[model samples]
Target: PLAIQQTISVYLIAYAAMSIVHGPLSDAIGRRSVILGGMLVFTLASVGCALATDLPTLLAFRAVQGLSAGAGQIVGRAAIRDLFHGDDAQRLMSQVAMIFGIAPAIAPLVGGWILGWAEWPVIFWFLTAFSGLLLLATWSWFPETHPPDRRVPLAMRSLVRDYVAIFLNPRFQRLAAASSFNFAGMFLYIASAPVLVMQHLHLGERDFGWLFIPTIGGMVVGAYLSGRAAGRMSGDALTRIGFVVGGIGALIHVAYAALADPFAIPWAVLPLFLTGVGVALIFPILTLAILDMYPRQRGSASSLQAFTSLVVAALVSGAMSPWLSHSTLYLALGSASLTLLGWAFWRWERNVCQRLPACPQETTAVEPADPL
Candidate 1:
């Protein structure tokens, strides 16, 4: 999908399409039930993905998988917010981030290994089994975090209104849009890296997994650091630091990509990992930023931010893959370098033009951030 770039649009489509319904549903059903259901569906869909023989079929199944996959990504943080207070929320999110941080780095390598030794079907089988485990974990260990008394009524009209209300908020839009662009930069990497690993660098499927380790490693480091230190620094300051680190990594990646001969493997790949570091730095801050903007509708706020990222990712992946077919450097470097410039613009807006928002209240209700 990343190689040809055509199939990835399907992945993005599935991702984006699912976001619209999942959050509202989570709000209606308890978070525990909604998340678990999604996991089961996600597991079966993973199996379908493993069974897929061609792009179209894989895509078809991915749509189902995408729908199922929305829960964990969407509800995970909301679950945390439901349970904790402000610093506590960041702390829990950080811890969860630390734990969840393992997925991106480990999953690909594990999948690559499974694909190499067995058929791709086995990968889906693993996912199926993994989902079952998640279901069991949720059932046995997790409780109803979102109490029935506190649950919001779900309605089509209300859902639409909720979505509109989010986009309508200027503060929400800025933070959400900024995070979406940042994620698009990272997703551009996800969609393009497979080809960059396999085709450009002459790696096999298993090697592709191994290649993911460094980038994920950077992500883990960034997330851990951000989580630990978020208390000492303003969230805004912390977020900017992430963008700067990420930007530096992106620039280095661009430089290496431009100078490389055929495909040096380590050359641009190292910088690519650095870009991952940048993403790691930015992800939590973006989430928290949007949360501050619209705390009451956290599920909606998270959903919108997630939806935006997935949508932006799909569009970016679809657009850049065709153009950057021959040049991995051009693709990765181009998108990320541009995101860096955007971060600069956003930072200026936050600092100078926009009124700095006050520290967000710890309550779960939707409220203004500080102010702009």
Candidate 2:
């Protein structure tokens, strides 16, 4: 599994570099074709993983899978936004996310079992088979969502314009940066967890599953509450609330490190639990707000989100986490710092957008995002 995380990081890097290409490519080639191509790549990568006997091979192929996975994620998000707009789009995307979320919840438990009962290669075989079935489903039933009439050329001139628009949109960049920081905190924890828990704490993989349960449980709570409170609270308000909560949780973790109690189970587990809840609230809201910013290029915007988040996470995992071992304070403070950055960005974005013209964020005093 540590190898898997490293491989996953490799995929993240590949996705960061390449996901934008697929979105526009889909615009030209058609959604169904693009989806099928991504699925095929994913399946082939799975097979490569299954056949991999060394870390390098697995990492390379996992990079391929990451690229494909990134495409699938961006394509799915764009396709939904294409099908609907505004609040309707948000609801639909959440439902799609719910479907995808189920797998991660199940995947950890299943992967733990595989790690327990079978060798690592078996895990790849499972992925290979699962991806193969998905490929079949895509080929059989998925119609082209991007009709010929809707096709937009993936020209370099347009791509540059598209990205420039995203970066230039101060609101989009802030939101992207906020979410990226949020993700960095989460991914930093994930990268560190295997070693921190398994190697240092001597917890078994199955125990790790139990630990994962709480974080997801928190997320479920946040999601449910956010949904119920949707009428009374703006998504930005929800994000603010999540930021406060996540920041507090991270601070607690950092505090434990400062006190030389980083090894205490409560210190590790509870903060992660809180972090999960905060992220659940933050994710749906942040994503909706950003996706709302770009009507024509939701795909590209999503690519940017995934790109920034994944690159930060991957770099932190590969370089930073490994460097902090044996220094509990560094590990905790380093992780907590990302949360602090995210919280600051969120507040700043809330303020700056207050000065915009025709601010759609008629939350009165609330800030609005820049153009698409």
Candidate 3:
């Protein structure tokens, strides 16, 4: 179990480290090229994983997979901001999120089904085929959203400086922290899935859907509602509501963990549904807000945001999950704590915006400024 957890953690660590580069690289070159290159690398890494003969070899390949896997998500976000604005951007983001939410729910089931007929290597082979198709699709259809005229010059000094400036911005700190913590709240459960499902829930590998389906169902529903609420509602209002829903879910989970005698199905997992909804609701609004902060440096901003989230996710997976997975109550407390911290950061950002005239409003887009 520890080895399995370590394997997952190493991938996330590599992913978080490389996340910082993918965005700035896309900013320097073009979104399409970066994405295609990353997908190609990911496909090759999957092949390596499929063929790896030893644990060390498999871990190395998994790290490579992680290194390349983040390009699409990080760069794709910048591309979205490049092409769209305001409500249109929000709607598109939500739609994309709704589609993306399906993967987590379906992935385990697919892997289990594949395992029924073939060995574990086949899973990596399947990933290779999947990423290969994505590479072809991207090559055939994806356009260069960031034109050459708007591209940032590739310089290590400039990259470090931009990252420092973005990372240091008070608004960026709060927004990125808020989004990262919120996601980590739910990710705590996901990271502990082996123990939570197999040991605590006393279920088999095929029963992962019991946890994932409810969690992702809430996310999909929330994403759809977020898209619908795009033009009609204020981003602040939506964000506040999302936090409230997530808070309630966390509280409910804690209460259930405390009260439930033996921890049954459906009842135990249902709260995650609300938490997922909350995550989806606030994600698009916060992401767009971060991207809007540095119009010329959206790629950098997106990269930093993704890095922050991925780092937090890595910690939760590698540290917190292992510590808390032994006790249902402890896991509930950890999640609740993370959600509360996220809400506090969001509230702090709101207060700062209200008090400062220069601070950008959450509902409106900010004018482009120097990357610094």
Top-scoring candidate (TM-score): 3
lDDT of each: 0.68, 0.70, 0.87
Model 2 TM-score, all chains together: 0.84
Cα RMSD (angstroms) for every candidate in the order listed = 4.5, 5.0, 3.1
Arrange candidates by lDDT, descending. Answer: 3, 2, 1
Off by over 4 Å in 3: 99-105, 354-372
Candidate 1 on 108-225: residue-level lDDT in tens? 6786678677866787788889888988898798887887766667776677767877777666666766776765665566656677777787877767754566677777777777
Model 3, residue 238: displacement in angstroms? Answer: 0.4
The candidate scoring highest on lDDT is 3
Q: Tell me the spans in candidate 1 whose CA falls farther than 4 Å from its real position.
A: 1-11, 47-60, 97-106, 352-372
Provide the global lDDT of candidate 2 against the true structure: 0.70
| Model 3 residue 356 lDDT score | 22
Clashing residue pairs in candidate 3 are: none
1-372 per-residue lDDT for model 3 (tens digits): 566666676788899999999998998888999999999999999999999998899999999999999999999999998999889999988877665555655777788879878998999999999999999999999999999988877677778877877887889899999999998899898878879999899998888889888888899989988999987888888999999999999999999999998997988899999999999998898888888888887888899999998889888977899899999999999999999999999999898775222356432222223453
Find the number of clashing residue pairs for candidate 1: 7
